[model samples]
Target: MVEFAMLVIVGGALVAMVMIYLRGRSGFRVANPESGTLYVTGVSPRPDATGAQYVTITGNLTGPSVPGTVVYGRMAWDVNDWPAIGDLIPVVYPSGKPERWQLSRPGARPGLGS
Candidate 1:
């Protein structure tokens, strides 16, 4: 009986976590996402005092709407999957906010700088 109750509690927690993740994903779709060439000009030194590594990928947009706008975003520790300098990637943003561009892998991209 106790095992069943514990399973229910764990299941509920997992479900809640999925819901929260989905909710945040909804924001990524709140506005139309634009694609652009990611120009990685720099990357900051990682593993700060908190021992947390962060990668700041910088680039710009070239679509009709946020054309050539300087944009940047950060991601968690040692993302070996991140693109190289002068690589084309997808850039997304909230509605009417070009400066809030985010770098994301479109569909099922596997190769770096592909």
Candidate 2:
């Protein structure tokens, strides 16, 4: 009976470890590219953003050279969709630099700043 109990405990521990590992690798944080533009699949308002409404955008790099690159940024948008934690959005870099992950929507009108 003792041996059986030990086996059960060990199995439970192993299962728990696997779950924890998987959860850690779920890819939640937004990875910014070398450019300033942040590629996000979605956007979400920051908890503290009040007047202007700070936002966190999440999206994969859609640029030709860097595909599948996850990106995120903290900024303010005029829209209401409010990207969620896992949404994906496009990004545009002005100088084509990787570190400049700060980007705006592609083909955004001329008045928008870089």
Candidate 3:
């Protein structure tokens, strides 16, 4: 009985792990990264579930699409790393899909007053 119980517990754990992995992968499925512009809109006053801040951005994407298609996106950042309002930041997103984007320069911080 004890062995059977342990086996069931292990199997349940494995199934849970697989489900979590699949969900994460599908939730963040972006591809064909291309350069786009980010117009800082505002920063959230409260932190997210992970205790990270979120910056809101809205702008027209420069990818292959019907021009003038604006995208509104929010990116998580450290509390002290939020961008200033009206700032223009270069970002990369999947071609024709600027909603899912990230900073073009790896590890680059925004709004340094430069």
TM-scores, all models, native as reference: 0.51, 0.38, 0.54
Q: So what's the TM-score on candidate 1?
A: 0.51
lDDT of each: 0.60, 0.52, 0.65
Best by lDDT: 3
Q: Over the stretch 1-114, how does candidate 3's per-residue lDDT look in tens digits?
A: 999999999999999999999987645544767776666555455444444566665665554452545667676666655566666677777776666776777447753323
**Over the stretch 1-114, how does candidate 2's per-residue lDDT look in tens digits?**
999999999999999999889877652333443333233456564554444466666666556455555656676554434455443344544344433455445324212212
Worst 10 residues of 3 by lDDT: 105-114
Candidate 1 versus truth, CA RMSD in Å, comes to 7.4
Cα RMSDs of all predictions?
Answer: 7.4, 11.0, 5.9
Tell me how candidate 2 scores on lDDT. Answer: 0.52
In order of TM-score, best first, we have 3, 1, 2
Which 10 residues in a row give candidate 1 its minimum summed lDDT? 105-114
Q: Which parts of model 2 have CA positions greater than 4 angstroms off?
A: 1-51, 85-88, 94-99, 106-114
Candidate 3, which segments miss by more than 4 Å at Cα?
1-29, 45-51, 64-66, 105-107, 111-114
Going through the candidates in the order shown, the clash numbers are 0, 29, 0
